[model samples]
Target: MLMAKTAIITGSSCIGRESAIALSKAGWNVVLTARRADALKETSLLCESLENCLVLPGDVTDEEFVKRLFNETVVKFGRVDLLFNNAGVNAPAIPLEELSLEAFQNVISVNLVGPFLCAREAVKIFKNQTPVGGRIINNGSLSAHTPRPMSTPYTASKHAITGLSKCLNLDGRAFDITCTQIDIGNAATSLTARMEKGVLQPDGRRMPESTFDVTHVGSAVVHIASLPPDVVVPQFTIMTAKAPFAGRG
Candidate 1:
């Protein structure tokens, strides 16, 4: 029998949950992680089978916790084929000058450092695994390209993720490991629910924005993950049709 591929999704958010279900249904064993045990349990329950799904609740920002998460994944699945770097947090809406240092640090710790640590561990396993490779998909939110009215910390962290993805892609070439980034915009998750209620815009106006289903992200993830080891999708952007993603100030 062919050994099933395995994937780890961070954040345990709606996108992570949907991607877990998508990958599980596609015959890939999945390990889901996040800070919330309840949320991870909920997501794991949505998978194809509890047997194929492993819920490892932990904080991605904690170095020790991230290490343990990857260790357990490899022990359970034998190898990791994909890592969905989706855990992220946004600091409060405040002008750069007014943004608290603590808030900015927290955002960076979760959105930037967390992915870095996870990718590092995943790359280590990818290099040493019998199959000799894996894919990493980072969730670089829309703010990665353009900033909202008062989203300095969040935007900065996401933009940094772009650089991190590029570096990993270049370095992993010889090892057959691949890195991809998906810049998402207004996916209809609880996080984006405020968009429907009118959100602050760059033009200093509160405008109701459009949102697409988060499952679209999950589908994109599966498509990217399904590629052969030699193939790499370096970057992809998915957003709502009407999202203010084109030439916004």
Candidate 2:
């Protein structure tokens, strides 16, 4: 019997939770990970098949923890076919000069370093496994293209993720490993609730921006994940139609 495909998703809430559920509905074994055990369990419980969903709560930033995450996934699921490198954090919306060093570093650790560590491990497994390849989908942001006011840390990290995705695509060609960066904007999630009220705009004005359903993001990811290994989408941007991203300045 052919074993079901498996995907390891980081970030147990919002996008990660919905993506895991979507993949499960599509018959993919899922391994959910995050810092909070309770939240991970909540996500696992919502999956279409509880039997196929494994909750592995831990920090993605820790190198050892990331290695263990992949190891345990392989041990439990038999193999990892895809990795959703989605764990991330954002610092307070403060002026760049006023942002604390600790805050900036923390964003980089979670948003950038965490994905790097996980991708490194996934590539190792993908290259050595029988199939000799897999896929990685990084959760980038509209900030990767244009920055919002008081978003130095988040924007910088997202911009770096774009570069990382390109490098992975170039290097993974030899092994059939494909990398995709999904640049999302104004997806309606807990993190974006503030947009409903009003957020700082480029001209120092606070304005409420439109947001799209987060489930769309989950579906988009599933579509990308379900594609043939030979076909790759290097970058995809999805956002609300009315989102100011077209002229984000």
Q: Top lDDT: which candidate number?
A: 2
Off by over 4 Å in 1: none
lDDT against the true structure, per candidate, is: 0.91, 0.92
Residue 96 lDDT, candidate 1, scale 0-100: 81
* Cand. 1 TM to true fold: 0.98
Candidate 2's C-alpha runs over 4 A off are none
lDDT tens readout by residue for model 1, 7-29:
99997767888889889989999
Question: Per-residue error at 23 for model 1, in Å?
Answer: 0.9
lDDT of each residue in 1-249, candidate 2, tens digit only? 878999999997999988998999999999999999999999988999888998888999999999999999999988999999999999888877898999999999999999999999999999999878999999999899998878989999999999999999999999989999998988899988988899888787888888999999999999999998888999999999998877543
